[model samples]
Target: MSFPAELSAAAQAVEARLAAAIQALPDSRVRAAMAHGIHGGKGLRGYLVLESAALHDVPREAALNAAAAIEAMHAYSLVHDDLPAMDDDDLRRGRPTAHIAFDEATAILAGDALQALAFELCAQPEQPQAAALTLKLAQAAGAAGMVLGQALDIAAETAATPLSLQQITALQNGKTGALFNWACTAGPLMADADPAPLAAYAKALGLAFQITDDILDTEGNAETAGKRLQKDAEAGKATFVSLLGLEAARARAQDLITEACDALAPYGKKAESLRSAARFVISRDK
Candidate 1:
């Protein structure tokens, strides 16, 4: 399905900005790896960032910078996640994984460079308070948040047995939800929004998105999912479906989506796009 017109337009603008930023980088193997990871995909995380920004009345140009920053972090994570040390996948977004497209060493370097670029993009002086808010994004996507989540995920997969439902959810929250949370929170954070409500909305939507992702991984196809299918089960990774059964897991995802929408209600009609995006998260096939 297509995103809302505003979201789609914002995504296009963000993609253009990101491409320009990447092109300006020094030409090298690392830049090539970064480009490979960033060029494909639907730009879903970036869309989320822009949509959330619109919800808070952020200007389109400012929102585009935030979108680019979030996408950079996401692309970096995907490159690292596909490495041999991580998921060891051979394909991503219908193309060779970064480690396969480039050597593992180059892929690793690319991920690192992308991480730096994410912060750099955020720190750019164009937007007021961009530097401070970009640092916040770094902390959210770095060792304390997404990185820690990934460490737990890798351990869960390699352990003698799978993790419990709670453990798995926690891991997914950190690895996947942290970035989603950052995407939503970054816009509000940059705008100096009311901290309590902004964070509540971001956290709820982040978890909701991840639970829906678990559902899709179980039932989605490699072709449409843009990655391997049932790979979580093959890896013996604990998931909501594995613990709660498919139907129950689906129900829980729906509940989370409802909670996410509720959290945004206080934002009133301004949050319509964000509300729609939340529904799309749960309803998405991929």
Candidate 2:
């Protein structure tokens, strides 16, 4: 199948699984909030999870659940990220953000509930190891990691002097790459594959994904991006593009993509989907 076709198929499968999970929620408001956050997004993280699992020959049914879990976590993060205490944006996916669409308290509760649901889905009967992997994801997304990065990001915006490139990269790795890494690495965990190499590949590809995002925000249109454009610079946030300039940042992203592909060498043809997904990271318009 072609890349776009494959991505669409994966997206559909993940969406179905996510919808089912959302329907099973006990509270109507929480379910509505979760669906609003998840139902119409780009599904990039879901695509990544599915592609990574496919790379290891995981069954489509199994991959769908994992993809759904990953996307649930991603949606939760975005909902929280747009809360008044975080990025404070009023728009996402070309619509009012969760906090704006609902109340701030509802949005916050939605984010928290979705996070718990992600782990709960992972722990479901079909995949016992998913429970352990979910713990890993929590560590990556929680206060010591993504949350810490976000805090630092807000601080950088308030600081008189800009953060160093190294510090900025660290923040990007935590805030953005950590979840991508989990999405990729979780595949191997679910498949009972040896995880060392997969973990390394995930780390490299995750950073590459963030670097490319930084580059895109500088060159992309707000309409295509589904959010405000140039807000990073306006907010005085540190980014690879801001630190290294577009050309150098693009080069760095390419280098990381190369490293990510190289890390998958041992998997041979099994890794092709992941390789293509990595290339897509830099090639995407939105």
Candidate 3:
């Protein structure tokens, strides 16, 4: 199958797993909001989990939960990020944001539930490397990583001066790169192998992804992006594009994609999907 097809298949499998998990919860507005929050994403992070798992020869059954867990965590982040006090986004995944679809309270509760569920899924009794994976995830998602990046981002908005390119890179590394690192390394952790190569790949991929995102915010169509675009520019915030300029930002993203692909050399041709994914990262409009 083609890379896109494989990615879609992986997404469907992860989505099914997430839906089943959510369905088991007690019925409430929060439950409904949780479902809404997880719907319609590209599931790229989950795809990374499954693909890296494949590279490590881990069984799909063993890895599916991890993939689902990452997607759930990612969804939760988006739900909360779209809250009134955060990015204040009104649309997500081509539909109303969770806070808009449900009430703000329900959205907050749903995000909280999803994040808790992510840890539960990763630390399931029968899961391989359950304790290790859970610990790593906690570190990746907590104050040292994603949250720290978020705090930096929020602080940047009010700073007297725009952030430097170096500062933005550091912020995105924590906010975006941390989860990608976890997803890529989860397979190796499960198989008790070295995660260095995929970790390196993820670092480059994550930065490239953010650069492309910044580029899209400047040049992409809001209708196609399925959310508000140019918000950073409108807010007068510094971004990769604002710092590097459009052509330079695009070129830098391409270089990072190459670096990401090069990091996959140990897996040889078996890693073609990941290579394709790297290329797709910069090419995607959304």
Specify the highest-lDDT model's number: 3
**Top candidate when judged by TM-score against the true structure:** 3
Cα lDDT tens digits for candidate 3, 13-32: 99999999999999988999
* C-alpha RMSD (angstroms) for model 1: 1.8
Per-model TM-score versus the true fold: 0.94, 0.93, 0.99
lDDT of 2 by residue, 93-164 (tens): 889998888889889888898888788777778773766777887888888777887788888888898899
Error of 1 at 284 (Å): 1.0
- C-alpha lDDT of residue 236 in model 3: 91
Q: Candidate 2: TM-score?
A: 0.93
Lowest lDDT 10-mer window, candidate 3? 1-10
Relative to the unseen true structure, what is the C-alpha lDDT of residue 35 in candidate 2, on a scale of 0 to 100?
85
